[model samples]
Target: MIEYSTLKQTGRFIIILGIQILILNQIHLGGYITPFFYPLFILLLPFQTKGYVVLLLAFFTGLAVDMFSNSLGMHAAATLFMAFFRPGIIRLLSIKTEFEPEVEPRIHVMGKVWILTYTVMLIFIHHLSLFLIEVFRFYELGEILAKTIISAGFSVIIIMLTHFLMGSARKT
Candidate 1:
């Protein structure tokens, strides 16, 4: 039988996936920004989660989004890359003494600075990989770079806002 925790996580994933596809996918700032909040799901997974599980979840999440967005495999590649690098990023920015066991990442749990740094760095990496893959060539390097940075910035803001709102709800 599936564990209660696993079932809850699955339900939450489905809800987030629907919101991402039905809501966020419709939002675009003239090709300059596309808020990709789905990555935050993978990002905020418990730190103690196994690397393989993270990678698999990231791959499937990207693939699902790609299916909905009709962007082929671009999302999958970028997301998997982000998942692969997340552990190292956390290790780099996290304080060893403050690390907790099996804790999910959150602004409240990790503090504002750590959360901000973690989100920015991961968003940058994810956006860069995604833009590069979407371009598939270096002909419009400047345009791609601009789009990546702008989109990443927008995505970071949205993700943080969502995190804060969710955190507040959790406390109530």
Candidate 2:
């Protein structure tokens, strides 16, 4: 059985994924800038989480979105792609201080710069994979780049706002 706290976390993940698919996915600004918050679930997961666990969560989360959005592997691929790199990015930007493995990457815990840098990097990787797979052609590189940038900006904002609003910003 999943631990109580882990269950609660799972519930929150489901809620955020729902919001992304049922609401945000429908709002494409100028037909391109669609907000994606589901990836934040993966981003917000505890830093100590095992790599395979993270990959599994990311795959299912993106798969859930893919099923809803009818985009078939785009969300899953991008999310899984980010999952593969999340550990590296965290290590690269993590301050030279030791931390418990279970500490979450919340804004207050890591500070705004760390949070922002981490989110931006992963979101960009996710979005780039998403948009590139979407176009599926090298010729439309400009369009893919634009879509990735605009969508990533929107995603980062939502992730940060939601992270703070959750009242979990305990700066340690």
| Candidate with maximal TM-score | 1
Show where candidate 2 strays beyond 4 Å: 168-172
- Can you list the residue pairs that collide in candidate 2? 48-101
lDDT tens per residue, model 1, 1-172: 3376578668878988988899988987885467888998898788887789999999999999999988989999999999989999988986573455457888778888889899999989999999999888664888888888889988999889988998999899
lDDT by residue (tens digit), candidate 2, 1-172:
3487689787988899789878998898886588888888999888888889999999999889989888888888899999999988988896554567667888667788888899999999999998888779664788788888988999899888887886464443
Q: Give the TM-score of candidate 2.
A: 0.91
Number of clashing pairs per prediction, in order: 0, 1
Q: Per-model C-alpha lDDT, please?
A: 0.86, 0.85
Clashing pairs in 1: none
